[model samples]
Target chain A: GQQVQQSPASLVLQEGENAELQCNFSSTATRLQWFYQRPGGSLVSLLSNPSGTKHTGRLTSTTVTKERRGSLHISSSQITDSGTYLCAMERSSSFSKLVFGQGTSLSVVP
Target chain B: SVLLYQKPNRDICQSGTSLKIQCVADSQVVSMFWYQQFQEQSLMLMATANEGSEATYESGFTKDKFPISRPNLTFSTLTVNNARPGDSSIYFCSSSLGGETLYFGSGTRLTVL
Candidate 1:
């Protein structure tokens, strides 16, 4: 069984629209990070949201430690935002060893 | 800022052949991780590399199939031995300095035929 799971395997949104991606973990996470991966490319760090809410530009991430859930909100989606979003978390006792989710593939259309 | 770089962006190898992927970090890091992704799918952890000791491989992965060496704090190498079609995938090397965020390299795309 996967420790971290992402919702809405795929999403399609129009430009200027807002979209939310969800991540649920079966175990408690001491650290959580969000990443974006373009088609045929590497994964890039988007936000490090261990707990509470964090906002940067038009992207916001909220993580609920107790509930073992995390959410990433994208506002005014752009074409460049079309990619796969992944959520990864690490256990408290681990030395930053991360377990990744399946990821949500999002496409922003004009 | 921590940056990781991988060598041989892409390569095509014959079956049973071997290939080596290198990961270098801009600064000294404690640990590095190797991951494999197939067809833009979910990433699977292959192994964890640390300086001055043998690499730790995850279940379903063997040191004989994928040998990892951490010569120093800032450099590591992963070698895929006796490659097969199943070995084809994009390999990424990542490291976290002091934070939980793992910074990944550009990744090496391997095609085994």
Candidate 2:
């Protein structure tokens, strides 16, 4: 079974619109991280939310450890924000072992 | 913050041939992870390399297919054994410096013809 899971395999939004991606884990994770990869490009770390809420630029990440779920919200998305967002989780014992979600592909049209 | 460097941004190899990918971290890391991502697809965890021990591979992946070596804390290598067209993908090396976030290398794109 996959330890981490993501929702909305694909999404399309208009420019200046907001988009939300969801992630759920089956195991108790002590570590959680989110990443973004542009089309045909490498991944960049967006946020590392292990337990609570965090925000950076137009991105926000909220993690509820008790519910084993997390969400990434994009405010007033732009065309540059179009990419695949990945969520990863790791158990307490496997500090370095990260299980990744399939990711959500978001496309923002201008 | 730990920065990871990977060599040979891209490579084209023939079937049945093999290739090695290297990863070097700026700081000492206890473990290194290898991932593979197909075109427009999600990353798949290949194996976990720990210093002074054999790498642990995930299910459906065998050590013979993807051999790994971790000589020290900052360096590791992953070899694609007997490459096939199906193996063509982007390989990324990452390290976790005891943090919630794992720092990733730029990734090596491999094309097996």
Candidate 3:
């Protein structure tokens, strides 16, 4: 079975501070996606990056396929950013099936 | 991106009763996936549904316990048989359209007593 590991299980940051989240996979993945879930809410896709670096607004995702690792960076974090960030990977053989990491909980304070 | 609409945003049922959750995709998709999430936990893959075919369940999930149907490409259903208190959890419906990114529904929160 494939496994995804997320670092910094939880993080707290002051508003305007920067946050960095890490994700590592146990096996080769064909696809990697980042998701944000608010308390008692559904997951919202943040970024989908299997390799290289991608940016959307103040959020950036970088993935190194050969190393089986990925990272998400948030600049000037805001209070609305408080939530759980999850990383999911789809193995090369599994097609659309995704294996999720434990997730990194982020709390931003003013 | 496909938008998934799930019915019965929340449900409360007595033990031993059966529960069914419906998921409808706005556009046609190749497959639909069902995932379970416990309180403060990550998502767990339950099964994969394809049109006109029997769903492929993951380990520890049985067809008798959780039966899935994909009669068409735009619709699917999941039924939990003989529900128990332990069955209380959030169930999410998701699908991807020929890409890596997946779109998810709001999810159904089930509480069994």
Candidate 4:
């Protein structure tokens, strides 16, 4: 069974529109992190939210640990923001072994 | 924040050969992680490397197939032995400062034919 799951496998939005990505897990997580990656590129950490809400630049992440769910909101989508958004979680007892979701592919069009 | 440098950005090798990828962090880190990601798929944790100890591999991964070495706090290496076409994937090395935020390397793209 997959421990982490993401909704809306893919999304598309205009340059100025907003996008929301959802992530759900099956177990209690001590840590949750969001990452962004361009096609054929490396990953960049966006936000780390185990619980509650966190904001950075135009990105925001909210995680409800008890509910085992998290959401990432991207404001004012830009072409540079077009990439794959990945959500990963670590079990409360584990050391940093992250279980990643399938990820939501977002494309920002001009 | 820590910076990780991975070498051999892309490589293509014949089946049955071996390949080695190296990752060097700008500063000392407590642990480093290895992940494999296939095309259109999510990242899968391969193993965890800690300095001065045997690497801890995840389920479905073994030292015989994917050997890792972390001799120091700032460097680690992952090697694929007897490579197969199925082993083709992007391998990334990541490390964390406090186990909350993770920094990733550029990734090594391997192709076995």
Best by TM-score: 4
- Estimate, for each residue in A1-110, the C-alpha lDDT of model 1 and write its tens digit: 54899998999999999999999999878867899999888888899877899998999999998999999999999999999999888775454357889899999999
True contacts kept of each: 0.67, 0.47, 0.72, 0.72
**What TM value does model 2 have?**
0.90
- Order by TM-score, highest first: 4, 3, 1, 2
- The RMSD of every model to the true structure, in order and in angstroms, is 1.4, 1.9, 1.3, 1.2
For residues A1-110, could you state the per-residue lDDT of candidate 4 as single tens digits? Answer: 54899988999999999999999999888878899999999999888887899999999999999999999999999988998999999775344568999999999999
Ten residues in a row with the worst lDDT in model 4 chain A? Answer: A89-98
Q: Record all residue pairs in model 2 with backbone atoms less than 3 Å apart, i.e. clashing.
A: none
DockQ of candidate 4 relative to the true structure: 0.76
Question: Which candidate model has the greater TM-score, 1 or 3?
Answer: 3
Backbone clashes for every candidate come to: 0, 0, 0, 0
lDDT of 2 by residue, A24-110 (tens): 999788767899988667778889887888999999999999899999999999998988999988665554457789899999998
Candidate 1 residue lDDT tens string, B1-113: 68999999999999999999999999999989999999857888888899999999888999999999999999999999999999999999998877646789999999999
Task: Label model 4 with its docking quality class.
Answer: medium
Two-way TM-score contest, 1 vs 2, winner: 1
The TM-score of candidate 4 is: 0.97
Weakest 10 consecutive residues, lDDT, candidate 1 chain B? B94-103
Which residues of candidate 3, in runs, are more than 4 Å off? A93-95
> Tens digits of per-residue lDDT for model 2 on B1-113?
78999987899999999999999999999999999998877788899999999999988788999999999999999999999999999999998777566788999999999
